[model samples]
Target: MAKISAAEVNKLRKATGAGMMDCKKALVEAEGDFDSAIEILRKKGQKVAAKRADRDSSEGAAIAVVNADANKGVVISLNCETDFVAKNDDFVALANDFAQLALNCTSKEELLAADYKGITVEEKL
Candidate 1:
């Protein structure tokens, strides 16, 4: 197997928001192929999501915001499997960011399809 460089792992981490170890493992498993590494990371996320699909996610945060015009309002909710994760500062900030993104959305589909940073809001979540 080819050696996985730290730079490569960091690049993958930035693109996928995956952990350092995960990015490194994916890169190793993909033999340093960036696209393949991304797919592997995505599959890992999907697997985790499927496994947790039936789990109770009653813990999280909700944020409501009004546009600068004061005419449009949006509410966003982010749910997590654990109260600890829900209470995390990053998690709360993410919920707030979603609320701001929601201001531009006319429907749930639009919100999901909208871009947050460079990726779709759905992908971000």
Candidate 2:
């Protein structure tokens, strides 16, 4: 195995927001290749997501928003695995943004397909 330095691990951590240990392990597994390490980390996230797919996500926030005209309104629910995460400021902000997006959507499918920033609403979640 090639030597993986602390600098490389830190770099990957900053780029991916993954844990220090996870980044180091990925760098080692990828033989110090940054891109491959990112792919490895992303795959790990996917695996974890798949494993948790069946878990209940009953804790979250419901948000409602009205357009400037006051004639249009939208409401949405964003679910999370834990109350700690559900109450996070970023989580609430994202729910609000989704509600705002919902005002423009004609259906659930359109809401999911709508763009949030640069990514789709489904992808953002």
lDDT of each: 0.90, 0.90
Show model 2 residue runs off by greater than 4 Å: 1-17, 23-41
lDDT of 1 by residue, 1-125 (tens): 97999999999999888999999999999999999999899889988888888988999998999999999998888998889999899899989988988888889999999898777888766
| TM-score for each predicted model, relative to the true structure | 0.86, 0.71
**Residue 74 lDDT in model 1?**
85
Q: What's the lDDT of the predicted structure labeled candidate 2?
A: 0.90
Tens digits of per-residue lDDT for model 2, 6-110: 999999998777899999999999998999998899789878878999999999999988999999998899999999999899889989999988998999999
For candidate 2, the per-residue lDDT at 81 reads: 97
Off by over 4 Å in 1: none
Query: lDDT of model 2 at residue 94?
Result: 89
